[model samples]
Target: MASLKGLGYSGGMDIAQLKAFPLFAELPDAALSHIARGATPLAFPRGALICRKGEFIQGFYCVLEGVVKLAFLSPEGHEKIVDLVHGGSSFGEALMFLDRPCPLYAQALTRCQLIHVRKEAILPALDRYSSLARQMLAGLSRRLHQLVLDLESYCMQPAAQRIIGYLLREAETHEGQTREVTFPVSKALIASRLNVTPETLSRTLSCLSEQGLLKVEGKRILIHDVERLRDLGPR
Candidate 1:
């Protein structure tokens, strides 16, 4: 773990950067500026540990650039990737509100720039701005719903189906009949998230390629037949 010795407050982050995030998009400039002023920008190189499991939640974190992986370590020392937080998204808000320790570890999947908004700054703002509180609740609800869906996928879906579902979900973000997707994280991490072995994930990708549904080129995957790929997963 790298020390935060050289980490200094970033002057570049302002109201505009806060507005880029959906949670703060509707906030007035004054409010956004308040939040921005409270933000501490921190950069993490790939594989850097942002927070470890059982650590106290100090503030809410937003990914300004790059990706972060939330994972948990089992008693046997195996790690399970729970979720991936992308740019423009905020995390740790719920835990901060509850004043609880983080249940999982957060690690930088790539070189990342993040803004940490201290709890003291957010709680007062939440009271001063009802819209901010509502937005936070809505975001927490959506995260809960996603967790439910993940539970269903893990319990009811097969490994290959889960992989197919993951691919199809990625494809939906693009606007086309065919889509190109790239894994920002390692395949082993993805396999852990999908609850499958790395070899199983590789085999599933090979099968999809053999069926002419997709083409895998290193970390990039080209989905040749979107409909066929969707058919392999749960509707």
Candidate 2:
């Protein structure tokens, strides 16, 4: 809800919990301190835009808390959800690395805290810290893998399979079989991520529910059969 200066994160979030992030986990104490010196923390309430399309992105950002929705807007005023980024996940790297403006808008889906390191500051830190370099490389590799998967989904998968696959992947990666993984965002936003119309998504979910594959109770989704859902992946 407040800006970085308002949150009192004049230094980076250099805590043990930060180590849980594979990207920042291996840095030496000195490097971590250097990073901490320049980093700042900010908070956003749900539905607030952290960054917008065509804005000049200055650095890399990691979620210290809550979830963010990365999305794109069409010239005709259509919103397409691209990714749901949660805590420990990072974004804005593409713009930072390429020295270009942001291509998508990042909005907070829940009240959130975030830490950021400017590109200028990080370059010197990375030069002195091989571990940091390795971490960056690992992050890039992971991002590439995700991109490949997304491209595959867009190019080859049918809408039914894509929607089901999205839910199953979210369940595995983010939900982990909790009583019911809260559907963190609206179905319309989710339909955009899966490249389907909201009506189509509703119909697909109804079909799945009718078949005993899943139960949609308001915003919560109970996955009755994860493997059956997984099998919805592309052939």
Candidate 3:
């Protein structure tokens, strides 16, 4: 598939594209224009390392297309995915604002196009536009809340419960008695994200299948009954 920048973001991302992001959505055109001018547009192939841990982030970035994962890597090469950031989402804002080294590294899961908006440009804009500061705070708050929830789930939930909870969360849009959940990345990558071994994930899926709760076909799972699956775990 063709990448996003290849579709229309040629040369560099324009103010209109910058304005489409939630952080910039409320800013005036002039402020958006300034920020866009300073932002760097870049593309990456799958498996590209966008940034490394311990490196200082000079700016925040937003993915225009494709998927990326922010993860921590061990010296022995094991990985733990902290977040699966998809198109239209942003990262690095808090790290940049805090002037600290990144705790996690970002890598592309597919061909990706992103814009890096510099602190130099954003600081002035934030000073000029009070709403921008509020939006930044709101975004960071959401991330922190999610992290807390994740910690709770990791500490309290069992492996099957975590995997089932993930399915229900992903199947939120599907209506009626039946629902479907699709894995955005490979099951191995997902296993890492959920803090489970691939073998355990396969075993759990088989267990669920044997119970007639769902049918797994490749990366897509057809949920037989949403309520049954939901009732299997937490209330």
Candidate 4:
């Protein structure tokens, strides 16, 4: 278990950092400053539980650094990773408005710095900034689409194809024939996210390696044939 640090409503919250998020990018300086005033900075070390299933929602959380795993526990006590929220991303925006308990757990995959934007602050900001509301809706819609894709993959696609699709999507930011991807969280967590057992994930990677598609070294994966891997991905 990792120790937690709470910086309660830091008065020096950065307006520029808030601007970097698409949700607040278009807001005027005054609006951004208003949000900054109510934002609380929280630090969680690796393995810290940020939020738990059924916990009352406090506010929206924006990841400033490191990664957080959004997950839920299975009936058999297994932790199933639903999504990995990385730096520059925000979570719980929709829930903040709904006034309900969180449906999933959020845990720090590594040491993390996060901003908790209080619902009180956000509600008034929304009323003042129409663009912010649109961006929030757009963000929620995108999240829904991703969930639908995940459901489709789980129902209709093979495990190997799902893995290939994940790798290809990760490589999209880079331009090259070969790319290296370091799993931000443990391979087991990724396996859970992809709805596969750890052993199954290993076997699939081994199969891909034997086919000269990619090479795996622990958490680091090196794609040797990007085109072939892409071809194997979901259509």
TM-score of each predicted structure versus truth = 0.64, 0.62, 0.63, 0.65
Runs of candidate 4 exceeding 4 Å displacement: 1-11, 156-235
Q: What is the Cα-based TM-score of model 3?
A: 0.63
Better of 1 and 4 by lDDT: 4
* Model 2: residue 44 alpha-carbon error in angstroms: 0.8
Off by over 4 Å in 1: 1-6, 9-12, 156-235
Task: Give the per-residue lDDT of model 3 (tens digit) for 1-235.
Answer: 2222322356755888887778788898888888988788888878788888887879888998889899896688867677888887899988766889999988889998888788898889888897889888898898898787556434534887888888888888656433888899999999999899898888878777866778999999988877667755544
Question: Candidate 4: what lDDT?
Answer: 0.82
| Poorly placed runs, candidate 3 (over 4 Å) | 1-12, 74-76, 157-235
lDDT of each: 0.81, 0.74, 0.80, 0.82
Best by lDDT: 4
Q: Which ten contiguous residues of candidate 4 have the minimum total lDDT?
A: 1-10
RMSD, every candidate, angstroms: 10.9, 10.8, 11.3, 10.9
lDDT (Cα, tens digit) per residue for candidate 4, span 1-235? 2334444544578899888887888999998888988888888878888887887767899998899999887798866677889988899988887888999989999988889998988999998889989988888998998787556434534877878888887777556544888788999999999998888889878877876778999898999988666645785
Consecutive 10-residue window with the lowest summed lDDT within model 1: 1-10
Candidate 2 TM-score to native: 0.62
Report the error of model 2 at residue 57, Å: 1.8
Candidate 3 local lDDT, residue 165: 83
